[model samples]
Target: MDTTMITIVERLAWTSVQTALLVGLVWAVCRLVPSLGAATRCRLWWLVSLQAVAGLFWAQPLQLAVLPAPALAADTFIAGTDVAYAHAPALPTAQVVSAIHTVSSAAIGAAPWWALVLAALWISGVLAMAWRTAAEWRRTRALLAAAQPCADQTLVEALNLAAEAHGLRRAPRLWMSAQIDAPQVVGPLRPVLLLPAGARALQGDALDLALTHELQHLQRHDLQWGLLPAVAQHLFFFHPLLCLAVREYAQAREEAVDAAVVEGRSERRQDYGRLLLQLGVMPRPHLGVASAAPSTASLKRRLLSLQQRHACPKAVAVALTVAVLAIGVLPMRLVAAPPPPAPPAAPAAPRAPVPPAPPSAPAAPPALAVPPATDLPAAPPAPAAPAAPAKVQEKTTSTTTIMRSSDDDSLSMITHGELDLGKRPDRAYVLLDGNASYAHGAMDDVKQARRDLGADSQAFWFRQGTERYVVRDRTLLLQMQEAYADAARIGTEQAKLGRQQGELGRRTGEQARAVAMVAREEALRAVRHSTDINRDAAAEAARASLEASRAAKDARGNAELATLAQRQASLGAEQAALGQRQSQAHARAAREAEKIMAQALQDGRAQRL
Candidate 1:
C-alpha cells in the first residue's frame, strides 16, 4: 500500500485508456476516410502509400505526447517520500481522482491540434516531393536525341526488324554520354534503352542478345511497374530491407525479360550464359529512373535458368493460370476464417493491506525493522495530571500508549490509545471507513504482534503454516519505509552540502575578483614607468642645450639634479613591490579555489549515502 505503488497503478490505468482510444481512432480513420468519395481521386496505390506513411508520422506525435507526461509522473512518484494507503479511498477521493486522470488523458490526446497539423504537413510535403521526382524522371524523355548506328550497322538493322516483329514501339533512343558505363532504360511513360557507347560497338551475338534484352525492357514498361517501389524506397530510406526489395524488383524484371526472349528460340544454354558474362564486365548505376546493368545475383539466376531450361512459355502460362486461380479462390471454398483470438485477460490489481510481492522475492529474508521489543529499558512512569477548570481548553492529538497487559501475567505489553478529544473516546489513527489507511513500519509491527497474541492467532497460524508469515507480510512495508527514511537522510545531507558549497564558491569568487583588480593596477603602474623613461630622455636633451648656452653652470646645481634622479630610482622599487603583491594575491586565490573544489567533492560523496 505504498504511495509509489498506488501512483504507478493509477498511471498505468490512464495509459491503457489513452492507448485504447488512440488505436481506435487510427482504426476508424483507416476504415471511414476511405469511403468519403472525394473529387481528388488519386490511385489506390497512391492512397495506400499515403496511409502507410501517414500512420508512421501520426503515431509518432501521439506517442511523444502520451509517453512523457506519464513517465515523468511515475518517476516522481517513485522518488517521493509519502507512504500511506493504496486503497480505494476513505469515501470518494480515489474514484474521483481516477475519473479525472482518465478524462485528462483523453483531453490531452484530443487537444494537441498544432502537433496534428504539423504531422499532416510533414506527410503532405513528403508525398509532394515524391510526385515531383517521378515527374522529373518522366521529363527525361524530352531530352532524347536522334539515334546513331552501332558499329555493326547490319546487326543493328536486323535487331530493329526483330524488335518490330516482337511488337516493340519506336527504336530504343540511343544516347552516347561519356558517363554511361552499361546498357540501361530511362523513362517509364516514354521509355528509352541506353546502351553505353562502348557496348554499342562491340561485335558478335552477345552484343546483339544484350541489346535485344534491353529493348524488351522498353517494350513491356518494366520501369512503370518499378516506379511505386522506387518511390517507396526513396521515402523509406531508413528501412534498408525495403531498399533491398526494390533492388530485387529490378533484378526480377530483368530476369523475367530474359525468360521471355529465349522462350522458344533454338539456342543452346551456353548462348545466354555467354551473353550474361559479357554484359557483367562493367558495373551499372542505380539511377532509379532506369534499369542499368542487372545485379550480379540477377545475372547468376539468368545463367542458371538457361542451364535448367524450364518448360517453354506456352506450357508455363497454362501452369501459372491454374496456380493463380487456385490460390485466389481455394481458401474461401476450403475454410472460413477462424474466429478472432480471445483478448488477453487484464492483470489483477494489487489490493489494499495485501501488497504485491517484490519482483524477485528474497529467499527466506528476515522481517524488516521489527526491533526486538526488549531492546528498550522499562518505560518512565506516567505523571498524574491535575484536573483543570471547565473553561480551560486542550487540543486533541493522537499518541501511542503502551501498558503492561494485566491478563498475560507475563512481561508482555499492549499499545492501546485514543485521541483525547474533550468528550469522546474515539480510537486514534482508525477511520470510520472499513479501510485501514494509516500504515507505517512501526505501526505494522505492532499490529502483527497484537494479532499473534489474539484468540484467532492459532487458526490463522495453522492456515498460513507459520507465525512468521504475519511478520513476512508486514516486512515488505517495513522495508519500503526504511528505504524511504534512508533516502530522506541522504537528501538532507545533500541539501546541506549544496548550500555550503555555494557559500564557498561565492567567497572564492570575490577573492579572485580582488586579485584580478590588483593585477590590473600593477599593469597600469608598469605602463607609467615607460612613460617616465621617455620624459627623462627629453629632460636630458634639454639640460645639455641649457648647459651649452650658459657655460657657467655651478657644481651645486648639478648635485641637486643628481638627487632628483635618485628619487625616480626609488619609485621604480615601489613599482616592483606592486608587481610582487599582485602575483602573490593571484596564487593565493587559486589555491583557495582548489581547496574549495576538493571540499565540495568530498561533501558530494558523503551526501550520496
Candidate 2:
C-alpha cells in the first residue's frame, strides 16, 4: 500500500476506535448515573461526538529516549589516546549520529486498492446521509410555506398567555395549517409554532397546553441541541452506535423539555399528557421540524416520565457534565515522546607502522670541494644547532574488566599515562576510563561483543618530544547532542505553529458567527417589512370595497326619487285632462238646456201663435 493511503487508513482506524470508546464511555456513565438530567446526558453525547472529531485531526509520534551507558572509570577516554573524556555516553548507531536524520522513517506511500475502496464507501455513505437530510429539510420548509397564521382571537390570546407563563420574552409566531397533522416548532432565530387545523377546536386550556410545550422547546433551545446530533449522524452514518447515540440524545432532550414544561403546573400533568396523546394520534411531522408531540413509542416514554414527581438533581447533572468533559479531553493527552538516537558505528582497525629503509649508499658523496674558496666570511659557520630539547619518555598502561549485572553485561576499559621529563620529575595521569554495556540477551557471547567493539577495544597513546598525552574522541557523542538539540527546536516551533492555528481558527469561528447574526437580523427585518406591506395592502383593499358599496347605494336612491317625480307629473296631467273634459260636458249640457229651453220657448211661442 502507498504511504498516503496507509496514513489515511491508520488515522481513520484510530479515529473510529477513539469515537467508539468515547461513545461507549459516555453511554456507560449515563447508564450508571441515571439521575443525570436528559439535557446533561445529551450534552455529554455531544462532547463525545466532538471528541471523535478532534481525534481525527490529532497527530502525535511516540518516541523512546536513548539512555547513556554507565561509566566504569572515573572519567572517559578514546582508545589509544591519553586524554580523558568528560562527556556522557552516546548511542553507537551511525545512522542516528547524524543531526539531520529524522526520528522516524517514512512509512506511508501510495494508497492500496482496498484503502481507496474503503474511502469511496465512506464518502458515498456521507453523501447519501447528507442528501437524505437535505430532502427532509426541503419538505419541512415546503410544509411551513403552506401554513397560515391562526385567525382565532381566543387561540392567539391563549398563545400569548402561555408564552407569558413560560417566561418567554418573545413568543414564537403561531401558524395553523391543514397540511400538517401534529404541532411542531421550526426555525432557530425566528421560531415558528405550527399547529394542525384541529387545534382550532381545542378548548382554551388544552390549546394553551400545546402552545406551552412548543414554547418551552424554543425557550430551551431544544432544536439546536437536536441539530448537533444530526450533524454527527450525517458524518458517521455508517456507524450504528453513533446513530443510536443520536437517537438516545434526541429522546433525552424531549424528556428534559417535557419536564421543564410541566415543572410548576404539577396538577395539569394529566392534561398535558392527554394533549400529547391526542396529538400523537395524528401523523407525525417530518424529522426536520421539532415536534411537540413525538412518535407513539416516544410518547409512551414521555407520558411515563411525566408521571414522575421529581426531576434530576442539579448536583448530579453538574458532576456528570464535568466527568463527560474530562472523558472527551482525555484522548488528546496521549502524545508520544521523541525517539532515541541510534548508536554510532564502531571505528576501523588501525594499520601497522612501516619500518625505515636503509640510507641507500649515501647518494655517492657529491663533489664537496667546489666553492670552498668563496671566503665571504664563510657564511659564519652555521650556528651550532640549538641543543635538542630534552626528550621525555612517557609510558601508559591499560586494564580491562567485564562486569555482569542482572539486566546486562558491561565491558570496562581503564588507561593510565606517565610523562617522563628529562632531569625533572615525571608526571602521571589517568586517561580514557569508561564502560559500555550490552543487554544480556542482545548478543550471543564475548566473540560477538569483540566483533561489535572492533577498533574501539584498544587503548593507544601519542608522544611529543618524549612527552605523552592521551585524548578521548567524542565525535559520536557530539553528533547525538546536536540531533537532540535540533529535535527540541523543531518541537518548539511546531507547538508555536499549533497555537497560531488554534487562534486563527477561533477568530474565524467568531467572525462567521458575527456574520451569521448580521444576516439573520437582516432577514428578520425583511420579513417584518414584507408583512407590514401585506397588511397595509389588505387594509387598503377593504376600504376601497366599502367605498364602492356606498356609491352603489346612492345611485339606487337617486333612481327611486326620479321614478316618484315622473309618477307625480303623470297624475297632474290626467287631472288637468279630466277637468277640461268636465268643463266641455258642462258647456254642452248648458247648450242643450239652452236648446231645450229655446225649443220649449219656440214651442211656447208656437203655441202662443
Candidate 3:
C-alpha cells in the first residue's frame, strides 16, 4: 500500500472514533438538561458548531494527504503559514489572536450563495407579512365605518368617554354585531370596540367592562408584540421547542394583557368570564391586526385574577425574577470553567563532545566499498551433494483420490488435506516450487475460490484466520476419487438388491426360503452387480476426478500465468522501474570503485572515444 493511502485510513479511523464520542457526549448532555429553557437551548445548540469545528480538524489531515495542484499547495502554504500563523518574523500575541480569529471567521462565515438566495426569500416573506398586516388593518378600519352605530345611549356614552380617557383624537367607532357576543379590538391604527346588537343597551358597569378589554389590547400594542413570535418562528423554523416557546411567549404576553385589564376594576368576575365565553364562541379571524378573545385557559387565568381581587403584583414579580435568574444562572455554573495552567516543560538531555581519533590510526574505510571489475572473484562451485528438486521428489510419491456419487448422479471428488492461511506455523503456504505463484484475497473470495476447486477437497472447506486455503495433491486426489467411486457404487447396489429380496420374501409368505435361498441369491447377484457398478463407476469417474484434482494442482500455476501475462504486456513499466533502481545502485557502486580504479577507467574511456 502507498504511504499516503495508509495515512488516510488512519486519519479516517481517528476521526470516526472522535466524532462518535463527541456525538454521544452532546446527546447525553442534551438528554440530561431536557427541561432547560429556550435561551439555554439556543446556547446548547452551539454543540453543533463545536462538532463542525472538530470535523474540520479531523478532515484537515485527509485534505493534506491528497495530491494537490502546485498553485493550490503554494497558496495554502502561504495562507496557513504566513497569513494564518502570521509569525513569519516574530508575531505579537494580539496579532496571533487576530490571525486565528480571521481564519475561523472566514471559514465559519463562508455560506453558500444559495444561502443568500434563501435569505432573500425570507426577507420577502417578512415584507409580504408586513404588507398583509397593513392591508388588513386598513380594511378593518374601513369595515368599521360601514357598521351601524349603537342605539343604546349608555354604550355610546361609554365609548366616547373611554376613547377620550385613552387620549384618542377620534371617537371609538361604535359598531354592533349579532355575530360577535363580546366586544373585540377590531383594527390596528384606530382600534374599534365591536359590541353585539343584543348587548347594545348595556350600561355603566357592563359597558365599562367591554371598553376596558378593548382598551387593554390597544395599550399593550399586542399586534406589534405578536410579531415577535412570527419572527421567532421564521428564524428557528427548524427547532420544534423554539416554535413551542414562541407560542408560550405569546401566551405570556396575552396573560399580562389580561392582568392589566382587571387590575383596578372590581366586582367583574362573573361579568369578565361571561365576556370571555361570549367572544370565545365567535370564529377567530386570520389577520394579526385584530386581537380576538383570549383562550379558555387564558380566560380562566383572567377570571381567577378577577375573582381573587388581590394586590399581589409585587409577589408575582419577585417570584418571576427569581425563576428567570435561576434558569439563566445554573447552567452557566455547570458548563463553564477557567482554562487550566500549562504544564512545565521536561528537561533536555545533555550531549557529550568526543575528541577526534589519533592521527596515527589508519583512515576509516568508506561505508560501502565496491571492488574493481578486474579484481572480481571467481564464482563458487555448486554443492557437491545436492538434493533432488521438489518436482522429482513428488514424482516418486504415493497418491490417493476419492470419488462419490451425488443424489443428482454427478460425481464428487474428495481429497483430504490441511488448510493454512498463515495462522499455523507448520502449514503456512502450499509448496509451489515451479509453475506457480501465490497471492492473498479477501475472506469471501478465498471461500468461493476454495469451493470452485470441488467439494471433495478438505482444504476448500477449512478456514485459517479470515481466509480459506486449498491444499492439494493432484496424484493423491485422482487415485482416491477412483477408489471411493467404486466403493460407493458397490455399497449402493448391494443395499438396493437386499431391499428388493426382503420385499419379495414378504409377498410370498415363504419367509424362511424367501429370506434364505432367493434372498441369498439376490444378495450374491447384488454383490456382483455392485462390483460391476463399482468397476464401471471407477472408470467413469477417473476423468472428472483427475480434472478436479488438476484444478487444485493448477491453481497456483494459473495465478502465475495471469501475473506473468500482466507483466509481459507492461514491458516499458518493468523496464522503467528496474532501470531506476539499477541506476541508483550502480551509481553508488561506481563512486566506491572510482578510488580503486585510479584514473584507469577515465583514460580507457577517453582512448575508446
Candidate 4:
C-alpha cells in the first residue's frame, strides 16, 4: 500500500473514533438535559461530523493553523552538563545539532494484515459509491425530465412566500413530477422543489407548510451540509459508529427542518405530522436530494421533536459548549514540550603540556598543493528552465466525414483534434462516441437488458433513504433478503416439490372454475335470446348436454392414463429379460476362451517334442 493511502486510512480511522467520542459527549449532555432543542442537537450533530473531517485530513491543525515566526535560540544547548558535579568542565563544540527528524509515519513494526485488507477495501467502496451516485444522478435527471413548471400560480405564489419566510436569497423553482410520490428539494445550486402530482390537492395551509418544509432545507443549505455526513459515512462504511453518527445527523437534520417549518404556525404541528403521514415515504434520490418525507429511521425522532421546545436552556448550552470544546477543539493546540535542554559536555584532561617542547624538523616544506573538488565552485545552474505543466491534457480525436467532390459524395479519411479543458483534474481522458464500441440503446432496450441482467448484480437484493454525503446503506434490504433466503433454505427438496405441486393443483382448479363460469354465462345468454315457448326446455337440454360431454371427456382421460401405465410396465419387463440374456452370453464366452487356451497349450507341447 502507498504511504499516502495508509496515512489517509489512519486519519479516517481516528476520525471515526473522534466522531464517536464526540457523539458520546453530546449524548451525555442530552442525558443531563433531555430538554435540549432539536435545533441544538441538529447543530451539535453537524459539528461532530464537521469536527471529524476538519480535524482530520481536510484542514491544518488548529495549533499550527496560525503561528508567528519563532525567535532564534540564544545559546548552543550542550549535552552532559552538570551543576552538581563541580569538577566537570564544559565543551562548547558539543551542541545539540537538531531536534526534528525526517520521520512522519505513525504505524510501527510490520503493517498489520487488517491494514492490507482495509487498503484493498478503501478505493473499492469509493468507486462503488461513485458508480452508484452517477446512476442515481441519471435517474434524478430522468425523473426531473418529465417534471415541468407547475401551472398553479397559487402554489408558485405560496412558494415565494415560503421562501421569504425562510429568508432564502433565491426562491427555488417549483415543478410537479408524476414520477415522485412526495415533495423533495433537488439540486445544490439552483434548487428546485419537486412535488408529486397529488401535492396540488393539499388543503388550506398544508401547501404552505409543505413548501416551508422544503424551503427550510434550502435555507439551511441542508442539501450541501448533509453531504458531509454522507461523504464521511461513505469513506468509513464499515465503521459502525460512523453509521450511527450519520443516522443521527440525518434525523437531526430533518427534525431541524421540521421545527423551522412550523416556527410561526406552531398549532399546525399535528397538521404537519398528518401531512407527513399522508405523503408517506416513497423511493426518491437519496444521493443528491433532501427528501421532505420523513424516513422510517428518523420518523419517530422527527415527530417527537415537533413538540419539544425550541428554546435552549443556558446550563445545557454551557454543557454542550464545554463538551464540544473539550472533545473537539482542545486537542488541536496540544503539543509536547520541546525535549529538556541537553546537558553540557565534559571538558578534556590538560595532560601533555610539558611534552609540547620537542623539536620538529621542517621537512620538504611545500610541494605545490592542488585545491580539492570542494574548493571549485559549482557550474552555474541553467536559468529559468520552464517546468512542464504538472499534468498535460491532450486529446486526440479522429473524425470521419463524407464530402461532395464535383457531383458525387466521397468518404473522407479520419481527422484528429483536441479540445482544451483548462485547469481541471489536469489529466482527464474521455472516450466519447462510445456508441461505436457500445451499441446504441434506448429506454425500452435498457429496460429489457436490465430484465435480462437483473440476476447478475443481485447481492443478494438488499439496502435505504440516505443523505447526500455518503452513498446509501443497504443493510436492511440485505437483512430482509437473507431472512427470506433463510426461510426458503430451511425447506427440504421434497417439501419444496410438494409445495410446487400443490400450487400447480390450485392453479388447475382455478382454471376449471373459470371454464365452468364461462360455460354457465354462455348458457344464460342463450336462454336470454331464446324466443317465447320452449325456452325453459331448451335451456334444460343444453345443461344436460354440457354435463354429459364433460363426463365423457373425463372417462377418456382416465382410459388413456391406464393405457400409458400398462405400456410402462411392459417396457420394464422387457428390460429385465434383456439383462438376463446378456449375463448368459457373458458366461458362454468365458467358457469358450478357456477351451481355446487349453488347446493352444497342447499344440505347443507337440511342437517341442
**Top-scoring candidate (TM-score):** 2
Ranking by TM-score: 2, 4, 3, 1
Looking at candidate 3, what is the lDDT of residue 183?
61
lDDT of 1 by residue, 85-136 (tens): 1111111222323344455446534634444454455456668767867666
- Residue-level lDDT tens digits of model 3 in 1-609: 233333333433444343344434434543564433322332233333333234423433322233333554444433343232111122222233344545544654555555555555545665776676577658665656556777879757866777678765666567776555556665445556676666434455666666776666665566554544454344334335444444444444544555566566555556666665555633333343223444666555545544544433454434533543333212111122332332322222212212211113224447774322211112212111111112323222111111122323453322111222233322122112121111122223333443445333332122234443343445432333343343334334434443443343233232222223432343343334333322545533442343343333333222322222222223323333333333343334324323222333334321111
After TM-score superposition, the amount by which residue 211's alpha carbon in candidate 1 deviates from its true location, in angstroms, is 2.2
lDDT of 2 by residue, 209-285 (tens): 76666787777777666666666677677777777777777777777777877888888888878877776644434
TM-scores for all candidates: the values are 0.32, 0.49, 0.34, 0.46
Q: Considering TM-score, which of the candidate structures 1 and 4 is the better prediction for this target?
A: 4
lDDT by residue for model 4 (385-416), tens? 11222232333221111111111143221111
Cα distance off (Å), candidate 1, residue 300: 2.6
The number of clashing residue pairs in each candidate reads 0, 24, 10, 14
Better of 2 and 4 by lDDT: 2
Error of 2 at 324 (Å): 1.2
Query: Model 3 compared with the native: what TM-score?
Result: 0.34
User: lDDT per prediction?
Assistant: 0.39, 0.50, 0.40, 0.49
